[model samples]
Target chain A: MKLTIPGEELMGHGNLSCQGCGGSLAMRYALKALGRDTIAVIPACCWSIIDGPFPYSCLKIPVFHTAFETAASAASGVSAAMKIKGKKTTVLAWAGDGGTFDIGIQALSGAAERGDNIIYICYDNEAYMNTGIQRSSATPYGAWTTTTPAKKFKSAPKKNMVEIMVAHKIPYTATACIAYPEDFIKKIKKAKGFQGTKYIQVLAPCPTGWRYDPAKTIELSKMAVESGIYPLYEVENGIYKISRKAKNKTVKEYIKMQGRFSHLTGEVIDEMQKNVDKEWELLIRKEEFYGHTKE
Target chain B: MKKVVTGNYAASYGAKVSRAEVVAAYPITPQTQIVEKIASFVANNEMDAEYIKVESEHSAMAACVGASAAGCRAYTATSAQGLALMHEMLHWAANARLPVVMANVNRAMGPPWTVWTDQNDSLSQRDTGWLQFYCENSQEVFDTTIQAYKICEKIGLPGMLVLDAFILSHTSEPVEIYDQDRIDKFLPKYNPRYKLEPSETHAFGGLTTPEWYYELRYKIQSAMDEGLKEIESVGKDFGKMFGRKYGLIEKYRCDDIDTLLVMSGSTASTGKEVIDRLRDNGERIGLARMRVFRPFPKQEMRKLAEDVNKIIVIDRNISFGNEGIFFSELKSALYNENTDIPVYGFIAGLGGRDITMKDIEGMIKKADGKPKDIIWWGLK
Candidate 1:
């Protein structure tokens, strides 16, 4: 099937985001895939600020900047309204990790359970970047945020949001990253085709918050996938398909690229590797259970 | 079309006539039937709206906010715990200035977990910057719901039309449903002056520095202050179109009265009946039904309270450990005014108990003399 990526820039230039802000890039790519008919339900995140002040916005699409936790519900509403008007417009909820994993979980779960026709995309930069890089549930274990300093790095593992979304038996759920623009665009276009609730988790790396070289943002994301730290996969109708399977690389390669994880010692690094390996094992099991490898 | 409907049905019917684009709601007691009827309307294609069956009340409001922001009129109904669950998003819908209309069936919040009628749920969100209107009867419930959209859009604020749970939500009465064509003329299609449009570049709910934060908040306040006039104008227009005039405060037989009974919601109907009986008996007792609660009709309330030798406030909701919520606001409104009459606060019909005309008579009798800090009525 030929991919029909939007050629027009619905999200225009001159945004207020920092250079190489992953969240802004995520929105731009998402708009390119979803098109001008897409309505973005933005929660309280950096994108809310990046959208620019009132009477001045960067995006050319209709954006409803809702509360911190209301993106999912708001998207559901917009979808319903479109259905009412007999308009086949896509309602996309663009939120950050803090909005998705923490405050917005309830609304997200509700929308997912009801199978409300919406596309919920979470740009996972790992922390609440808008609130001064505070640790969120999406923050990886052993990562250091302002709230969880080097002395007291995050102890809890990052919540498995894609699995949770798949558990709702939604039409589509996928993981994408900025490093793989084609794959990211492909997944978004595929998501647009699905009928019911569709969710996309994009691993958007923030240079300022992650304390990495702004130019290396895409490189870090690529390393994150190659090192098996952030595997790219898609779940459709309970079937899991590993979209990108990279050669196994050292977790240290992914960690050392960002200062947030610089505090991890050998033991903590090993622990992180063990956790990633265990999660990968589970994904492989799911793939085996659902995808059924060709003979 | 006309029907003998309950206040809840009236609200639902009003929403139906308004051609609400989306109806997102979760079922809670008292308010369940309101959404049930709305759902049936959508399911039957009687109303062209998407009836979103959300998991919780919080999402219900969130969905309405989304629909409104998408440049479509949206509505939802909830009571008590459902309203409490929607507390945080209520502020969001208001601040985002989405002209979403919600009908809050006033019920007490839970601790022991009661679903009875009380004003605590809506009153608790007094500072949320949404326009709040209380209804006295099925007619008002139906009329106010239609009028709220106009007021909300005019002031760029969301509106909450509240009716007492059980007392108003379930009770049946006479309500005239207007023709859809007439309603269309009265409430033209919602054309939001400012909305999220891809063709136009504009931001919403963005970061505000200290320099602009206060100004934005003051703008909201100024809009609210101007809303009073807008509300009155809509009320008059609605009356002229629909033959039902509602105001910030609806006065009853207050002329040449020495004592007045101040109340809101269904209980005001009871107060009116009692006031009529007392007037017939040659007692100088009158009734003041407060229609608009938030943007608290302060000046009008004070002017109305000035001539009365004694003022009695009947509140169906309490603030717990303090006087009645409405009473406190009333007292604040009358504070420093030249009213010599001693103000009395009477808490009544808590936990959804029926407030009869006899209860109003008792409250009127008690108000003839100085009463305690807060007198609890219908406790037995």
Candidate 2:
């Protein structure tokens, strides 16, 4: 394999993240791309604990652990403060799915709408993994979290966060998977080049939350993209482009590999497959629509 | 430069002259004009600062925490419901020990929905480890704001300068806006020992176990204990630079008095006038206006209480299911004193009801050296 990723490690070892924690790798790759002159504003997420206790941190860059709902807002503050000081430091708001899709959505929306100069990355683990495996709005349909037991799985579909960011007409919005480090790093680097709000949601599979083998974290992340459940794509300046084409794997294969979806019946899996297909079709149509227009 | 401006504008000028590097605020009734004036100043290039129009007061304070932690002077302003919304971040800013100063127009909280003056909005945040300053008028609003930054930065805590809604916020008064060079000399740049710098990286507010969490809280209390002395010295420093003096509590004609009237914010102004008229009639009364409420001037209260036979605290804010909030805190402050002074509790002028000089006189007569649950004045 060609060594395309940066060799200089910004994230040190001995992090407190669980074994095979995809969120951990996501932070590592992001810091490598953003370099050392970056300030990360993290909310109440697994990364908050992953950075170790107070007076000690795992990353080389400064990390500001903030309240659960104010990651984007705090990042805006950091950006504003640095801007006034004439410091060219990259402000990154690194949050989990719960902080992004649920409690943090308002602050994220406000930051995006204002076109604040900050890079926001949401490491999507599908649930609130830090507190426990509780279901968040990012949890896909038929997913079983602690809050959504076997008898009552999550009925709602996962929120389409990229489209929401695209709606804000920000400079850039992308979806990358942890299995593809090159693509994730590329998106973060490209986001740093832009001078406004840039959002990227990276699919990070959690073995503890998903009830899968710890060693299968990378495998599950790859399967999620190949199965068309989480297509790697980016929206730049109102134009959508799929970064990686799906490998034509079935959604059932992706679901059966994870214990969180083991109890789902064939009928529910089929419905979820149909939902994924429809979303992919809509994304393709959006690309085609923009391609045909002057915008 | 003596500029006739509203209390809200005085706050804007205060932040401007203090050279705040970043300002984040959300508009609420009685506070909207403060940010508006700040926006005008920024737009007109009068002040060089980043004004973040955050979506809510929670984010306003959150941005202030971020900006302040990032080693910049951060400021913000809000009102009643907005201040209540910022309750969580208030604790965050204080715990992180960020010297972020804010202006809160004291508006009454609502169910019937009002935009009226009351101290309940700021008094509710008494336990949040923030230095609270209640301004008596527009000049005090301007003067205290500059002094708040100096005091808070010295103590490594956040400070809130409050002025009553409409009475101070909307009312225009002559405020002397000091020269920028002199104000800058009084309050130097905010140079924090620890900040969120990329060159010097460290995790702030991360998870701390019980072994360190208890001690971290004790440190905050210790800083507040130091804050009392800082507020006094900073007030004197500000007075020496400018002609206006300040302290935790302002004493008016309390040298020789049989009774002392205690109040805060605009009510203190009323109490001062009422005291002058009563003293003219040889009533032997004085007034103690609570300027800084957090490091509650207990020592000052005890020293003054020894000379007076009675203490009357008129609170515009209620603790609900108890007597006036100030009344309760005042009694607690006097509890350790060996004096048997009858501290009277007066709950009046709630929800923006006008408390006239006559009302103050009536409360003074009603004290009567008697124990009362709550003397509800102007309650029809």
Candidate 3:
């Protein structure tokens, strides 16, 4: 089935994003899904720079570049203000992986638990791309960040942010990839249908941080989902649904494409693959059990 | 309506009457009651505002920034640790030029963990470009909160109304609640030239190169300069509308005085009583209650010290390794005036130590020695 991409674009040209920036494409698709009547509450992320410098913005909508840990709370305030003003403007909280899973987690969790009316989109680029590839909680195991060098690669697994959101019993939570614009856009539109906090963690690979060819950003995003390293799924209320089934591709095939994982020995790669498999198996079990159960 | 209420409730009523469109805050000691009162106002359908109970004080200030940027009047209340937590966002709010007013219950900063009245909390945030107003009473707290919104909105800057923790925050006083219609007339709807609206899409707080960052900051400094006038004018307007007038500083028996006592917050109120007692004993001492700290009130300080032979500052907060915060700032303000007047710096009542009338009189008597450095009064 051919996915009908929206023809009209809300994202303007001449953004400050790096070439082949998957995060930029993710934002472009997000804007298309959100339409023109939206406000973006961006935290300290690549997009904060990608949106361009002061007095200049790449999006047709208003953007509030907030502090690193305040995207959710700021977006909640924007949503509250919009409600007071009787305007139906969608407040989209856009943050990076570091802003989401680490520094911003408290505010994000508070927003979710309070059922703040905003769409919190954590564009998961793994490491802190804007700040020279520092290690973040969302950086997967066996990855080489500046803080977690090749000598001592990231030993911790990526945080399960969507699961945390689901635990808050929010209206919606999902995982999408930049390679799949249709799936990502669909999830954003679905989130717009819900009133409370809707969280979407989209896999946006960073070429600079991942030490991969800039041209392979999309391909790496696709590989991330296909290899079950980042699955495409949505959890509405308590119902879990896998939007796109993983192709069961080997993690080594996905890891070999990125230089950040090149130093990973076969043993470590196998261990990483085993962790992903265990996580995927648990997700599948959750879908089977909770998918049929009412929230 | 003449009803007795705590400083926290007065702040809630002030925010309520000023028609704050949004209130986002966290509960901290001494400041919890302010947000609690706001929550009660919202619950009872008395205030038409969105009360966002944020997780932390950082988020509280951030939400206010967002709400204000979104073309709504935003307000919040916090104390020492909470205000310290919000230090980063306080700069964010001011630099963004969002007219978000906050009520800070002046509590002492802690290492040994004490929640009591002091000016250190608010004074530490003095350089954040927020227009700081130190109130002496519950009435002033209420009036300043309203006037803060006006002054901040007019000058495109944020403002913080400060009242001493427990002394003013928890203590009940008979505050006159003005008619809502009159308040609406005084502080009209917050209609900013720019806002976070889609129709007038603009990026706020974006990454700026050195090319624009300097000018943006210069504009903030210039706004603070103009904020001095706005505070005075807005205070006058508030006075005209509701019989009680305010200014950058409130003078008590300063006329024909050879020596002036300078202080802020609750200590200023105690100083006034001391001034009256000293005058009865034929002492030529008076009190200059500093109501506004930001914009420094430099011109006021200069003029107030032009005729006085000596200036004495009793600070409820210390700057550590330096003199009292107010004393240091006041001395700097009077530096260029060529007054050569000796300003005595006395640090007292830190961590909520009681500053009785006797303590004020004693500090005043010590000023006669003309100490050149900081005097840690009542230090054990």
Candidate 4:
């Protein structure tokens, strides 16, 4: 827990990420935490293309690019093989929101239930950014994606993936954001110490998908946490603790920053704020209740 | 020891002797018993392997692909819907060049849902880059399941052994189970040149641009082309070790014959029995059992087509639009061979319907040099 970033870089500079790509930063920070003795399991996501073309890799470590929905299961298989080979190497399953929240959830659930020793990281950027910003289950309410145009923006709330992983009774589960690399890398290091299934959901803000300025990537991520939208928390073996709690900021401040949410009316913003406050209260209650066990 | 075991048990014993390191499978009709036996072996400490309990057939193939990529031997079994469910991963396993061996019991695909024998389940996966073998009986099922692993590993591809559902999977036959030491000599331990090694980093199955994508596909086709030689060489080596021999196509009394009936899977046995009586009745008829369907046995087809004037092709599965899958393949294979000997195509035994000796004779009788091009045999 030195809170010091590793000097050695695993990801090479100049790859296939867009300007201020939060997913690229997440992988950079994650590789620094996990080190060289790791194999990345990348399903069909932006990273699959972003990892560069054939015979030219972006990461220094080995990468296994599997099908769209096989990251968790393939990582489980890789982890099992590593254990059999008597090598203590990390098998990291890095996927996007579409691969994780929707298609790959079943395989992830199975691996979690079986207690497969692999670190499954979902760099959620809300929509399917790699596929031209299609609507995903991780897209927030009232956001405009290609699948959900401005006329009919997303009517559903983003999926609660941390809670879903926590329900699997996994040994480690955490939610981090790309803007906070110190906390993000620390949580990844902490997850690496465990012996069972570990899941970390990193909020990767895609400027292209969210219709935001590329320079405001870090600002929007910071606002997402400050407005009580994507809270920074970790649940270790049924013991939940909120790492960073938000200040009292209106939901309008978060929505107004993104053009995807520009079409939302004031009445819909008020309704979203109410729902956000309710979810935060539920999180606080659970954290305080589980905090008793930490004592 | 010659033990009377079902085809599913034979497949289990084959995997056991070949020392499959990982078995991840799901339960489907006709294929459930195959996994049940493998699970029992692992539970009783008889097999040293990881028996992963999967929720679906997709996960079954995914888990196998993972283990195989990690440089370990993996095995799984499935039928109709389960095979269809694993369709995407089947291509993944083959395209990744992982030598994963699978036993696919040939159950009919359906909206009516029949759990009987037909080739639709495995034949539909013909272009998946997996080498396919059609088995006639429980003994062949046991023998070929073991052979599939050795052939695939040498060629660096995936293989599936196909046997008729219920007919071969449920029916018991006296099969001589090979000993571990003997099998060990025939098939050595699998140690790949590269693996999911953490110490040495290498990219696997990652993004390939259009510049290199076609070459990767060409390499797979080359492996399959080399697979023909491996299957035959290994089959001969297997024959040298044991007494039985298997070729790409098993020709039965086709020399100096005026007519020859061609079929695959267990139906070939019925065709053989009918041909035997036809020969006794002074008729020059023969049977050609198409064992390997993936590579198409083109060289064998050319030789067989030249020997006979009329070719009767019996297909248990239909392709729905034009002709039978095997029928179409055979006609194309023999198209440029300069023989216009009418390749009579007959469809029978779909959705678990039995293909009797009478049905085999009917197919031969329909091939009497007339305009009966494609016949749907024994349909009410």
Best by lDDT: 2
| Cα lDDT of model 2 by residue, B229-251, tens digit | 99999989887989888898999
Model 1, range A13-59, lDDT digits (tens) per residue? 77888777888888888888888777788889999888887656788
Candidate 3 regions exceeding 4 Å error are A1-3
Best-performing candidate as measured by TM-score:
2
Candidate 1 chain B weakest ten by summed lDDT: B195-204
lDDT of 1: 0.86
Off by over 4 Å in 2: none
Fill in the DockQ of model 4: 0.68
Which residue pairs in candidate 1 have backbone atoms (N, alpha carbon, C) closer than 3 angstroms, thus clashing?
A60-B198
lDDT of 4 by residue, B1-380 (tens): 89999999999998898899888898999998899999999999998888778778898898899888888899999999999999999999999999999999999998886888889889899999999999998888889977899999998999999989888899988999888889899889899998887666777887777989999999999998898888898899889998778879899998889787888998788888998999999999888899999877887788888877888889988887887888889888887873577788898989989899988887787777573546998889
> How much of the true contact map at the interface does candidate 1 reproduce, as a fraction?
0.71
Two-chain DockQ for model 2: 0.87
Model 1 bad stretches (over 4 Å): A1-14, A18-20, A293-295, B320-322, B336-339, B368-373, B377-380
Interface RMSD per candidate: 1.9, 0.7, 0.7, 1.3
lDDT by residue for model 1 over B169-257, one digit each (tens)? Answer: 88898788888889999888888887655565455676667877788788888988888888888988888988888778989998998
Ranking by DockQ: 3, 2, 4, 1
lDDT of 3: 0.90
Compute the DockQ of candidate 3. Answer: 0.88
Candidate 3 lDDT over B90-129, as tens digits, reads 9999888898999999999988799899889899998898
Quality class of the docking in candidate 2, CAPRI style: high
Between candidates 2 and 3, the lDDT winner: 2
